[model samples]
Target: MRLRRRVSPLKLAVLGGVLFMLVLVVLQRDVSGGIQEPWFEDLSNRKERMLELVRGAVNNLAFQIPGQPGTPQLPAGGEVDKNCPSGFYTQAELKPWLERPPEEPHSQGAGGSAFQKDNLTPDEKKEKEEGMTRHCFNQFASDRISLHRSLGEDTRPPECVERKFRRCPPLPTTSVIIVFHNEAWSTLLRTVYSVLHTAPAILLREIILVDDASTAGGCGVYQERR
Candidate 1:
């Protein structure tokens, strides 16, 4: 007789969330009223709208009890502390650091307008096109931006900012895992920096990066440093 293993609820939630998002992406054109374009702009604008749906679905699944219709519940902050007292949120000096105004125009690809190819020189345009052909994205713009660049104030919602949680029972510490293959150096490093910058030090146990047989030169540099 062979034994069958039962999947954990957390694993089931993660798998279901992944499959849900994949299906949404696959049927994006049909669900989004047949809006289709080859460029990144079209997809970028609709991503937020798609994410809201995914969030709602995931949240609904997360609190589901066994053999019951999932009733979505908001996070219970009464028993656990959600906020970090020593986090960047309370640091007065660091508040301006991420959202600081740029000294020069078109510096570090600061705004949405910076991505427009209409303003690029012939040589610049050629380089960008070549980069896109090789990497399937705008490597040229990515190279110009700083790895720790500020995302500005409009990124978070007011409701999230205004919400408060209890500090009695501490929240669980988290270990972040990032996986990549042939990712650009600037973007990859930026993601690490972003996690370090935003996450509270006390709650962030460690970061584990998994490389999936990448042939890029960036991977060699990363491995050598390890």
Candidate 2:
């Protein structure tokens, strides 16, 4: 048998080294590129960069006050108070500081006494009635009459007046029921004002307002005559 050529150990070692280098290159391309570095590994560097950016922005916007060590500038024409470093007052903060009328000595402990005293006298009752007369006549009675008269007149064109009148159905009466649950006094009064202004007397028979379990003290006050 012919003798087979034997491979050299040196050549085999060289080939093995080349093969190992190729495998490492393939791993670096496929696995190393896909892996993300952990944030903990570079947290200190990232934090420093973020702090630098914030400090630069604040320095750009910050104004130096005269004779003050580190006071940020406020808007133009704004007043600063030593008590409030932020130089702003909320509604609650301003309410106690606002100027108000001097409280009456007689009405100090009386919650509803002022209104009750006015209702106790005959002259006061007459004055109250007179005051309410203007509101009732102008806002309610006259408005309702005007609406009724306007609807009673014919509004059809001359050409179709005769034909339309024959085919027109009778106007139906409507009752507007307003229900309020935990509604504000201003909101309830606005609803009544809107109905008085807009509703025609021919269509609207009556307006009924229903307040269901409201905690407001003056619900039925309007119903009572002076």
Candidate 3:
């Protein structure tokens, strides 16, 4: 009887431990009562914000430009062009750049004006025609002034412009490849100049100009001068 009494306490202790473990497991599962995740709400909000940004980017990409000849000439920055199919910035976003000056030209030097055939000598007419072919590589444009203007005139916010540049000796070289298929004279040169003006000179390995076959060809303007 004494032996049975001592074993009974041991059995009770084991049973109690088993019950405590079972209760603990049941409470672990039911503690949250199958509630939704706390972070799920935040995840949903972030997803909505990302979607909005993507939509804005797509709209901006669909920027316009006048294309058809006799397209009611909207002076540079005059109105949103309907012809340009896509762009990095939207019309509304570009409005600040387009608004005209106070009826007084800031600085007028014959810049990127399309060479007019009306009052040109035969040689001049030929040069102008060839220039047009290179302008868009046979692409169409109803307006040219806004884009052909100098890069200095760009109105973009200077987010990427470095306030301080890091210079290192023995800088690694880089090769820049610019492919042209009847590209415009001013813009092409600008594209090249843009690189030269921005990048560290020591790092520029080689500028490789590969020209795709373009039918546009003409007498070299400098060759005539020479």
Candidate 4:
């Protein structure tokens, strides 16, 4: 019989909190104008309800499966210690995955070539059409790109790079939540890696992923690894 290992309920609860925080960040950041009185009041009133919904969603997303013996958790630490000196988390968390070699020219979407059109053979066209029909996009083309594709360097201006916050009140670390529904495997993973690669571990607490009841074959692989 195959062995199954489940992530603890405590861990799943933590996952819920991460997602909850992410939702709050989005709502707060995307407000068209500054927070008005009525909006703030409504948000305050619904805060408990939102927490309940996030807990339910996270529990639904958690799963049990045989553990992969050697999969190292990204940004391996559970939480960033504020007391640590500058660059401590950066040195610890920036692994070889972020320093990947450049993709070959033959790789789809490499070197800004994704926009270039290719003359498709009849069979290729039929395959592309079928992929689009099933996933509502070109899954065939997406399959050709690496999941860990490089997105090039961070583009911060020189002034932004030079500015530093006070050590006494270090910037708060954040958890990134990615919610996907039947997304292409390559695109989904590329997004995950992109954040991991770009975001400094000093300011990134963790990544929480939520799959919203996806029934596509592309999601099967992730489910199997749960």
Candidate 5:
């Protein structure tokens, strides 16, 4: 006798979220001025509706998959303790990590370099594009690794680290969603983390990444560590 595989609700929810993200990625291309929420255009819109949307997505991705004991729950508001690593509920609660010192400034790098022939190996195929130049290739590349190499660490400015600049609390948390197709792994990941690091942790709720079915094969050095 053949047995049917059983799937849990949590799995189904995650699948729904992934599918939803994928759809949004496709829909975004069709919209001008980028994808925007219709309700957010007017203050008269119910804010809770947005939260409900977040709650739906959160429920899908949170908690352990199938066979797990933990269940998702909302956090009660209280005195701000620290940043919100959860990337959803606690963003409004984050204050400057004032106790920590400011980060050093990042130094700018050289002008640019095109994808050289020697750099293009058999493993990568992106260079095969007709008449592709270095400038065009670098334009699409990420500076995440370059930044780390040139700037040591903690490259944030004094204002970013100082708590004196903070506005009153009770701010709203947000979910970050990114959709891309055939994006360089390094650049795409850097974009993801740049958002995470630049924003106060408390202000972030969750980060959603959806692939738009990329076909960029590889770009030699770009793919080296992505």
Candidate 6:
């Protein structure tokens, strides 16, 4: 039996060139500053070595196989998807940022009309004023009555009057989970900042984020910011 010859130099060179181009396509999608510089340099050097190795292997394989051809070279200037890894987002994936929820308007005094104040009739204005006054008084009365009730009536006051009310212990902490399909970087960051600023540090435990299969590159920006 005759032993088959290895791949030829021509085939090996072609395979090597193809691998180099693949590396370039991969690098073009990188946007982060820190990763781009070092990644490009490393990829360039590694690609050179990879091309040589692939070329040699292809040549050897070509010789061994009677009719096997080397790997085909990809066309130049072709586009490649450089979106974030499997769990990450791509630019196109997060093209449109999520619309913000409408803001809650500032509350007016109870006596103020919901609509324009000028639209109210004299009778309506009088009713609103009376209603506001009653509401204020009720609140004030409740607080005062509670304070008085807490201090029981005693003919002779003890050195330390017995306090009747028992204060409740603190409640358990809670976690808020926000699920987004394809949220924008700005909106996501704003949400995080709002939570951090407003939520009581002791009461808030952790914020769990669940992604619902959003295909976007903005996820990378979110991660880097975090």
Please report, in order, the local distance difference test score of every candidate based on alpha carbons. 0.61, 0.46, 0.47, 0.62, 0.49, 0.47
Per-residue lDDT of candidate 6, residues 83-102 (tens digit): 31122223333232232233
Between the candidate structures 2 and 3, which one is better when assessed by lDDT? 3
Worst 10 residues of 2 by lDDT: 141-150
115-189: candidate 3 lDDT, tens digit per residue: 232466787656656656646342222222332233335455685332222121112468999998765644555
Which of the two, 1 or 6, has more lDDT? 1
- Write down the TM-score of every candidate: 0.48, 0.24, 0.32, 0.49, 0.34, 0.25
Alpha carbon lDDT of residue 40, candidate 2? 34
Q: Show pairs that collide, candidate 3.
A: 65-84, 77-98
- Per-residue lDDT of candidate 5, residues 38-92 (tens digit): 6433322343467589887775543523323343333567444355333233334
For residue 115, what is the lDDT in candidate 3? Answer: 25
Q: Candidate 4 on 1-226: residue-level lDDT in tens?
A: 9999999999999999999878876666545356666776477547758878987766433311112333222244555455543332234443423555567666656654563448989988898898899778777767666655654554689976554333322446788999988777767877887887677766778889999898865444532110
Which clashing pairs does model 4 show?
none
Cα RMSD (angstroms) for every candidate in the order listed? 19.1, 32.6, 26.4, 20.2, 20.4, 29.7
In terms of TM-score, which candidate is stronger, 5 or 6? 5
C-alpha lDDT of residue 26 in model 1? 64
User: Per-residue alpha-carbon lDDT of model 2 for 1-226, expressed as tens digits?
Assistant: 9999999999999999899667555554544455445643354345457769998766543332222333355446876554435522233322321232333434312222222232337865565455356333222222112111112235678864332110012224578899986554433564665566455444567889887887745544332111
Best by lDDT: 4
lDDT of 5: 0.49
Off by over 4 Å in 5: 1-135, 139-144, 147-169, 216-226
Q: Give the worst 10-residue stretch by lDDT in candidate 5.
A: 107-116
- Between candidates 2 and 3, which one is better according to TM-score? 3
